[model samples]
Target: MIRGMAHHVGIYTRQSEQRASKSEASTETQWDDCVSGLPHWGLEPQHIERYEDLGISAFKDVDRPDYRRLLADAGAGRINVIVVHYMSRFSRRTAQETYDDLSPLLRNGVRLISVGEGREFHANNLFALFELLFKLQASHEESLNKSLAVRAAKDLEARLGGYTGKAPFGFTLVRETRRTDSGKPVSVKILTPDTEHEAPIVRRIAELADNWITENDPTGSVWKIARTLEKEGHKTRGQRMAKARGDARWDDKTVKRVLADPRIAGFDVESVYGTRKDGTRSTTVAEYRLVRRADGSPVQRYTPIIPAEQWYWIQGWLSDRHPGGNPHWDGKPSGLLSAMKLLFCECGATMTHGGSGFKKHYRCRRRAIKPGQHEGEVTIGAKGIEQHLARRIFAVMRAADDESALAVLAEAANRYAVQRERTVALEVTQERDRLLSERARLRRSREAHHADRERVMLKGGFVDDFARESWGETEQALAERMRSIDARIAEIGDSKAVGLPYEVWLTADTDPTGPGSWWDSADFQTKRAFFRLFFDRVSVSKARRWAGRGFPVETRVTIEWAGGVDLSDRPMVGVA
Candidate 1:
């Protein structure tokens, strides 16, 4: 404000962190102080603009919107004076950054004022300018010291296995109160599983991810995983608590980021800086790297949902699936069996996506010179056929999980154990669990063999004949062991035992969506992959009429189920 002159004044206020009680007195107090002190300067403000940014830090990394707008207004001469309660309120960034922001206002002849600091600084005031720079330097140092103290405290808490920050997905914070040295009660929070709801979601996601690597089931996509979660009515951590920012629902990138977090494996993280190609430490910024010991092994603080091996592999998998890399699944549904080219017409022509929206269907384009040869073109409603296939696949999965079906023979051995093995001539203890347990043990053992390969690569990427011969022999032993396990697995569900059991890919029963409920929750890519597992090809006859809603899909779609052995060719056990 200038004596006996009217000026356009701008007031700016900000709050770094929101209060838990929902009261925002900090910004209001600053506004009140700035407004009350205006009369002391003997200035009448004709035009006024108030700028504010809440829950944003005045740092290099964070973008402050209102702050930027205020700067622009000052530069354009819209503000004759800019008022703040304190110098730090304008910025706590480094001296250089603080100078850059303030220089524009001073150059434009805008008077700068800090109501609390009792300092008057402008372009003409050289001593005051240096004084302000020194103040900015002090402010930055103070912020840096505070940040370091917070990090040190967090490190100490982590060492004591004390949980800090909001509990991530699949976990809940359990509070326990204890008396401190001075006899004051202090509440401590422990990260614990949300067993009934959240924990199982994580295991289910793990099972889906594990399928591609272990069962050779299908390539899983984070997009599809997100879609499945959406369909199953699973709210994100933010949406559940209702303090969330950004996405309103689950998304592919969000899913990937959540899975990549080390917290899922019960580990905390420390900020790690990257090194340049010349081997010098770069000053870009520190990234959150999973906390590891001096020996380079991960450290765990809580019970982990994933085994260390599986979790590490998942990290590798996600890295491969990053943008512009080789993805497990491209996050598109690819339209039923179209990607596989398994849907065919009666005349043997391949079917493809046609029509639009509700009228959308799979149509076989008429081909060949003679029109009669490609007569009665097949067109099946895509949604109806897809829904029907979903039911059939889930029904097969349902049969596998049914305990009653496993009583005489366990085609359902993986689901429910029928102590009786139909193919076993003599009594045997190796049921599905034992067989699977052994297979898992063999796989773990097989991982050790990879060290031999790694050693060769490190030693100039050449495998000598002698080393190859030794490795071959070692692999043969493991292969032979694996063959025995496979043979036992083959015997688990012989034709004489019962109908075929569709191996549950994702452990259906334990899922919150319930037994065999994955079909309803699956994304396009996932459903398409499962379709290939159960079907050789699906053919459709010519539609007699437009098979609209409520039409029976079975009458048009014919399925050829994939199997190791044709059921019709085998004999039953209980023949008189």
Candidate 2:
């Protein structure tokens, strides 16, 4: 022992219970061992400082507070020696990492000692350095091998029809008595149906889904089903319900998850693991198989609440209604003009549904929440706005000719081309593709508008002053757009030509009729799509009521077209 040097000894200890057994060295035990062996190294209790990282893995670079402090002290030449119960207690990091961390401490005149190995690491000793490297490598290998062994055991257990983790909903784990090697009784847990409490709820959910798929029930949508379940005082398993607040209610996502799970069909499912950004494994259900099955035919893991046929049927329904599949709108009709993204308050807040049916009005949602802070709810009768807008749209469609329509289309296409070029130059592939798709959709709409205009032009040459003024305004807007694009290109340091090629004018089949005719025949979904395609937004001013006027007194509504045209000055007349 190197004695009588008046050394300051620092004891470092770490114990991750998750990675080690009960018999392995704990933080408390390691601390005790280090304190007891201080006299052997000619160090007193007064000269010793302890650093402990309890329940923290040595293999991970976690924020070990005490360990970090100890390293700082060593670097500052405050600690002359570092004592650990074992090499692994200090770190189970690879040999290179272990060497790198300790080199600075050793260079600062700190001695490394392990009590369990009864070894002292000397800075100048080649043999001691070799031994330190060997110990670190062994520790790292042990952790790796242990992880592999545990995963293998879990896989084997899963294959043998055993639930390795927590049992899913509608089931409970029951322990069955078994004889051990010494004929002593032990318990083995297995999954069984929880029929009394959870099973009935699962059955009801399956029945509702089946009715929706097979019986064409209108009330069986996921949102409706969730609401129904909540109303019936049925709470989902594992979800805590607050009796006072009534906050814990069934949601659409929960309902969808329950319907999608294959476990309800009497199967055992295993998760496919994925690597996360933090270098941790994230697991998701990948595949399913009938539990306790020997033959190729499907077998029941337990008494299934939902029949196999009904379960399969529900799966087919889900697939059809999925986002990737053909359009099958399952949502309820919001309102007449709700599909039109055309209602906003002067304060730039969106207007949403406020009143009940027939008496319904579009109210500024932000103002409604805090009436004193914001401008009081700017509202307009839904029917009045819809009627006035419909008339205006009809007039425009009827008066437009092929020449005027083509001019508008060309201006819009030029703006889109510039936007696309900027997006591509920035190397934003996703955003560029999205802009291109929108441009394609606009092209199709333009073609339909041109066709309608051509039909009207053939009937009468309606070249009025209003049409001429509109064309002049449109031309001015197009020139401004070109200037704005040029400024943006200059700012981004790109000189690429934003020219629209002939191939970019590809069109699609979208129903093209006079606005009035289209509105008369179009369904709710089609009406919504049409409104979204043409108009960007609508701004509503605060209502002005005269003395002896009714509830809504001449609310001023302004419509903004998608093609940068503003009609704020032309206020639509309100309904009585």
Top lDDT prediction, candidate number? 1
Give per-residue CA lDDT, model 2, range 1-576, as digits (tens): 233566788899887853333355667778888878877766663477889887678876666788889888888877788999999888887999889878887765678989888888978887998999999989988987887896886665555455667667677777666555567654555677678767677787877777766665434567767877778777676453233334546777777767766677775554545546776764444324233223122345655666655665676555333221123544344665652346777777767765787788887767245443445557788767766655544333433354443443444443433233323433443343344455556556556656765776798978688876765575566456556645544454422243333232221232233333445676875555445444557777777667966434234766666454543343331121
Per-residue lDDT of 566 in model 1? 26
Which one is best on TM-score? 1
Model 1's alpha-carbon lDDT is 0.66
TM-score of 2: 0.40
Total clashing pairs in model 1: 0
Clashing pairs in 2: 342-538
- What lDDT score belongs to each candidate, Candidate 1 first? 0.66, 0.62
Candidate 2 regions with alpha-carbon error over 4 angstroms: 1-10, 18-25, 45-56, 59-73, 76-80, 166-508, 511-576
lDDT of 1 by residue, 1-576 (tens): 333456889999988975434343478888888899887776679977999888788754677999989988887777789888887888888989889888877876778888888787788989988988998888888888888887886665554456777777788888766555567665667788778767787877766676754643335668778887888888777676666342478888767766776677777665456667777766543344555444233456778877645666676455333232245545333467664657888777788776778988888865663654546556788888887766555554444354432332222231111112212333242365577679899888778897867777888887789988888888899889999988987876432232333443444445423445555576675566556656657778776655565436676666665532222222221111
